[model samples]
Target: MNAPAPLEIIAMAFSLTTLRVDGSPTPALCVDDRYWALADIAPEVLQPEPSRGLMNVFGHWEHSEPLLVAAAERLASAPPLPAPHSLEDVLTPLQYPRKLVLTGANYYDHMRGDAGHSDWDKESKAPLFFLKPPTTTLVGPGRTVRYPEQTAKLDYEIELALVIGRKARHLTLADAMDHVAGYTVAVDLSARDWQRDPRHLVKFDLFGGKVFDDSCPLGPGIVPARYVDHDDLRLRFWLNGELKQDAHTRDMIWSIPEQLVAITEHLTLEPGDIVSTGTPAGVGLATGQWMCPGDLMEAEITGLGRLTVEITK
Candidate 1:
């Protein structure tokens, strides 16, 4: 097979009320507002390189220096991004995509030495999965993740999310990568207490804790697939500025190619369909640190981009 062509890094921006540097809330831009669009300034400022994950953008201290400092200065001085429309007003023009399929426990190390192994066995035999409603999407930054009354043990999982470029069904591993349009940072917020209910069993509990409103916080930017080296990108997560989860994409037991093949066997993956590859271990629950109201969660992938959210009561 030939090497895939290099992808141009696409710029995506999120409007938020608060800046990561400061905790004060600012106005969030509406999803439909075109003012949210920002220039892909990373290239002109920094030397271009094809690296997968958020680091592809944030890794360049020199290039990102301007934006980061500008944001910081704004936080210290200027007002926040304008929230021009009401929530309902903004959601109206926003095109909500359909169908988001997530792969569970796709990392090899995560399935090692526990009930997770048995779960992996079942999944490998018949890949464990779940669906997230599009309405759950929080497209921009500075948005507060509300602590659902249904769950007290909210957790964060940072995973590389792929956006399908075209319709695909029954595709072979060899042709799988061709269907991906771009990549972004996805935080799969899991409610451990609700998800681990023995009464429902693991399979049914998969969606219980994970499918809440604003559970999936994506974007800030979307890097086209051509720019990412999917086989070996690094992913990391932090809570309140402390490192928690860290792993390489190459560690996935089931590669993207294999995952695409497995998923398409029964269902068609259409354009705008999203696939969140599994996250590595070290989540809040796994570490005995559950997310509470007022906690900050930040996630980053090497080539994709950084995504941060605040948990609210």
Candidate 2:
């Protein structure tokens, strides 16, 4: 198996999807900045089915990229092509990850408002994180986030999500990138009021506050690690069509490599594990503007595309 030449690859459906583009999943590729249906161009390569899932296309260590590049080259020389289907036309390439690990206050700006932290302006010696139930929280774009009724303050955090391709344990910072499968966008939707509530009997209210159903919205397809320019990628979050949070990945206090090294130091991360690299400032809590039912939230990063989610009760 060989890696596909540097190209931004995407996944489309050939079977049924929530939003049917061609009355079924539209198996296609976004390559060389164009769209080509896999069936039309690479029927011999593979077929799309929910059971087979996108793992064959995305999780493959060596074949995923090469297969995409071949298909893209074929489409480039082909005759008039059909218009590419919108990302909304397909389901998330990989649906749910086995583990959803979230970083906390990894961003300098985000630390200012972090709960009960006196060293908000100073850098920490190590990374901090919390785990969310993957099956309940992991969802794709176009999905409605069920606003939990227990809290009135709902918030959103836009973070660059790392997808682990192979098993990683006791990894060093120098070798961390080798374990990354790809990059995708993720929203760390939170119930701030619940997360910070001091009155709760449980000492670690952060768990209860952040682990509600539909709390983690991940997707809009994954961009293979080979194609991402991580040096200074732009990250933005919009609320109700208004730009709210904007920052660069370079500003992170703990670089992605360091974060990975810190996490894998004790815990073994398996393939398909997703670690969202914390959000920047300008969360709703900062302005006392909480999310309400019917609010539209969009989280976007430079290489990985945008993930849009609607808020509902």
Candidate 3:
């Protein structure tokens, strides 16, 4: 397979009408332009169901810069995009998403203990998958990650997330990349107690624990699929400014092509569908320490940019 070009980009922005702490409408731009308003755009430009307002912004950067300027002009003239209400207020332009699929233990070193090799051939016979509800998404940067009752050990997994560009079923590896619209940073927040439990064979509590309200903090921005060399990009996570998880995309046991091919065989992935490639090791659960109320979580991928969120009760 050839490397993807950088021009096929989709860009999304984190447009804020207010500062996160005071709730006062303070205009700012984190990814692109500060004045970008989702509500002012054509619905079709932001279409394809099951889409996250913010994720869609990040994934569809092709017209984003121009769109941002147009939104600012509209805001200056019309009733004005209302002051953001917890970031969700601007989501009117993004299509609502349904399911979020994530890969587990896809990293090379993560598979070394049992798989012996860095690729799937040396790893398990099949890809490991997990799901998170769309409602779990939290768009604002400073929003709190509530520590759910009964679960004392909470961890964070930093991942590169891809949004599906079109509906695809049984897509071949050769055509898999075509279905990708763009990429963004995702933090797969987990509750270690439920995640590591051996008694529950179905992992019901795992989803409940990890996919509860405000658990998934994504964004800051989305870089178009064209901006990254997916196979060789670098990803890293920092807790309180200290580097914790670091790895290259090349280390995945099951590459994106293989995973996309496998998933399309079982599920019809639609545009705006999110597939979070698994995180590298060094998560709190694996290291024996978990995140608490005051920790700051940050992640960055080369070309895709960076995202940081402060954990709060």
Better of 2 and 3 by lDDT: 2
Q: For each candidate, what TM-score against the reference?
A: 0.69, 0.82, 0.73
> What's the number of clashes in each of the models?
14, 4, 13
Q: For each candidate, C-alpha RMSD in Å?
A: 10.5, 5.0, 6.0
Q: Name the runs in model 3 displaced over 4 angstroms.
A: 1-35, 38-95, 113-124, 137-139, 201-205
Q: Rank the candidate models, highest lDDT first.
A: 2, 3, 1
- Which digits, one per residue and each the tens of the lDDT, describe model 3 over residues 71-144? 43444344433344544332211233566788887886766543244444544378878777775554445545
Against the reference, the lDDT scores of all candidates come to: 0.62, 0.71, 0.63
> Candidate 1: misplaced stretches above 4 Å?
1-94, 113-124, 137-139, 201-204
lDDT tens per residue, model 1, 97-210: 577788887776666622245445434365667888876655445545778879878888888888776678999978999888667778888888778877785444876878
lDDT of 1: 0.62
Error of 2 at 190 (Å): 0.4
What is candidate 2's CA lDDT for residue 77?
Answer: 78
